[model samples]
Target: MNYAKDPADYPLAAKDPALFVHQHEGAVSWGAVFAGGVGAAAFALILLTLGTGLGLTSISPWSTGASNAKALGFAAVVWVCVTSILTSGLGGYLAGRLRRRWLAVDADEIHFRDTAHGFLSWAVATLFTAAILTSVVSGVVRTGAQTAATTAAASGSVTMEAMQRGNPAAGMNTWPLGYFVDSLFRMPAGSPPPATAATTGSNETPRAETARIFLNSAATGDPLSPEDTAYLSQLVAQRTGLAPDAAQARVTTTYTRLLQKISAMNTAAKSAADEARKITIGVSLWLFISLLMGAFSASLMATYGGRVRQL
Candidate 1:
């Protein structure tokens, strides 16, 4: 009611949305919000860059604490929230404080206008920050992958060679999985596959049938069953020149080698990738929460700033 009677004392709107903004006539100033938003975004980039430097340097795959991906993900979310609040709050407050003072508008309307301006500033600042962050991350990832490939090439390591391939081979048999699989099989480079002998395109041969049996038998992580082992041994004896006992021995050796390789691969891959998947999920959830929090934070911060400006 303090400003109820003053409503009619001001000028009227001639256009749908006011284009000629009056410097001293409105509670929201676009120029001031733009300035504050850019400043907040710049400040956020600085903080995030510093945090990234510290973060990457701190964690390592060979170290003990490096394995704690959940903890790292939690910490990252907390940091993101803190940085968002600090940057957005400052920008919103500044937007509210610097906007034009509404001399003829009602106090309630003025407060609402200031809050809206702050919210707008927050939105703009977040977009600016996101652009910078996206560019930086994309650049870093490209550079890292390139560097990794270069280093692998220089070292003459098979793993690095495989990594350099644009599309890696499939796993185990049906397709190539990794360079490591070649090492597992230890077959001569030009030798026809032990399992693909005398095979036409469409129809499978006895050797291929044995391969299918072996692959199916090896599906479970455990070693091949005794029945599968015996069958595979017979297949090997028929295909190769070895005696039945020697064929079984070869099958046992081959299965043992594959089992060892798979076990090692499973441990490392699950260690690296499973945790990253979890981190990705956690970060996504945290980002949603942060966005909602940011909106509320800007509104409240702007309201308080507007009240202080009036006083």
Candidate 2:
């Protein structure tokens, strides 16, 4: 046997980890991995802020000034991919270059270790960035909600009075429901002023009752029962000074319209929810793709950095 031949060429039973631990147990440079990860996370934050500024400048609240949403969305996807590549590539290079060179390891093993270091760096960076972003979004949402609550509380009484003035039958009902309820007692043009019996003092009880009926119908998705229809029609006739038959017809029309409005509202809500689901799915898929690109970039760049360091 030649004395100069490599020892690695002769396979050793010592390579079996189940039997014995290897000597190169401290091969990983965790310090370097952490440094690279933190650097990458900082770089990602900078890129994200830049992207946000660019996005804000590119669109407007006014319809004519705003960029097309689909175009903006596509641009955002592209930016994410570019940001991931740059940040991960930099992190991977740093991780590979900062590590202490391994001695006596086979080339394949060195390559594998370098690749692992890069992947680990990328993973750490991803976790750090996610944590930062989550904290920021949570803070923003919390602040916005608190601000809105404060504003609403401050103007509650004034807003309530304005709404009541617009819809006298509203009482304590919400604005939308109040609007529909007010329609029930509207008198024909040129009709005599509503009788003194229909004055605010006398109208409150029936208005409240009508509001309750509408609310219950909306909640149950059921039309008014016959007893309710007749009772409500009688109330309308007495208040509006309309003929009994005309009041009954108006009751039928108003109830039918209310049901139609409720059905339309339900449809709109479902449509909006479906749209939101689709947007979320698209974002998730694009994010996955971006992350995959980051991993590939990191691994590839690490290999290059490792070769440069070895040289």
Candidate 3:
């Protein structure tokens, strides 16, 4: 009879500890983690680039294209969320399925490990993307700063040349003090006004003064005073060689137009600010929600992938 035919002929391996020894290893697999992270980052980058191209195609520099900023912003938000979900899910699934199997581990422990792998993959991918964006932004900012510096230097040289030509008003048009300086030399109501040649040259003194008055009124959120109106009317009459009543009427009409423009500008600015605030809030909320959803999606997909691998 052969030894294999007898039930008690073979010694049990469990009877000797050395005969069937096992060694446990770490559960975390760096190779799988890296692969998952790189995959997620690449997927995200590709999608983002495609989305940017699509956005650029939709916008135009001229008025002919659809220029609805709100719609564009909304679409961008939606795309970002979608990208997060897709890339995160794929990364998590890859991580789970590729991870080394943990033999003899508890089911609960395996589930926790899968979830951890997914979260870690997402975190690594997010950091990698952030690093790339930061590098790109820093490069752009550095280039812009250099260009601006060069432009400012050139402008400064030209300004200095203008100042050296004995023309006090050469660059005064751009200076806030020019308006106040003009006011200091105002002639009394009954006094003869200065010659047109003296006030009108290339100096732009009167124009600067007028602009300053309008700007000040707008900034203060107040209308021009009666005294200022009268003064401006007198100046207009002297400069235009018109009768007092005609000059006064022209001044009133011009001032009314200016006031309307200022009011419209204020309204537009307020509207822009409100729009920006809303967009900021919306983007923030969407980002948070998308990230939360990405986390959940990643973990769930990871577990599914792991289960499939086991099967």
Name the runs in model 2 displaced over 4 angstroms: 1-25, 60-67, 147-172, 192-198
Per-prediction TM-score, please?
0.61, 0.81, 0.68
Candidate 2 vs candidate 3: the TM-score winner is: 2
Tens digit of per-residue lDDT, candidate 2, span 1-311: 54334444434523543322233447788987898899899999999999988876666666562246865787799899999999999999998998877655668988998899899999999999999999999999999999987976665432333442433333344545566677899878998766676567877778778877766665556778888888998999988888888988888888788667767766887898998999999999999999999998888888788878878
lDDT of 3 by residue, 11-48 (tens): 44335433222114577766776778889889999999
Better candidate by lDDT, 1 or 2: 2
Model 1 Cα shift for residue 61 (angstroms): 11
Clashing residue pairs for model 2:
none
What is the C-alpha local distance difference test score of each model?
A: 0.65, 0.78, 0.68
Which residue pairs does candidate 3 place in steric collision? none
lDDT of 1: 0.65
The model with the greatest lDDT is 2
* Candidate 1 lDDT tens digits, 1-311: 34433323344423412422342454458986897688778878877777767667657777676465545656677778877787778878877777765544567887788779778988999898889779988999999999998975575444422322322221222232332233323433465565554543322344344444445544564667889878877765655556788777777877676556656766887887987897678778889888777766776777777778767
Best by TM-score: 2
- Lowest summed lDDT window (length 10), candidate 2: 13-22
Candidate 1 lDDT at 153 equals: 59
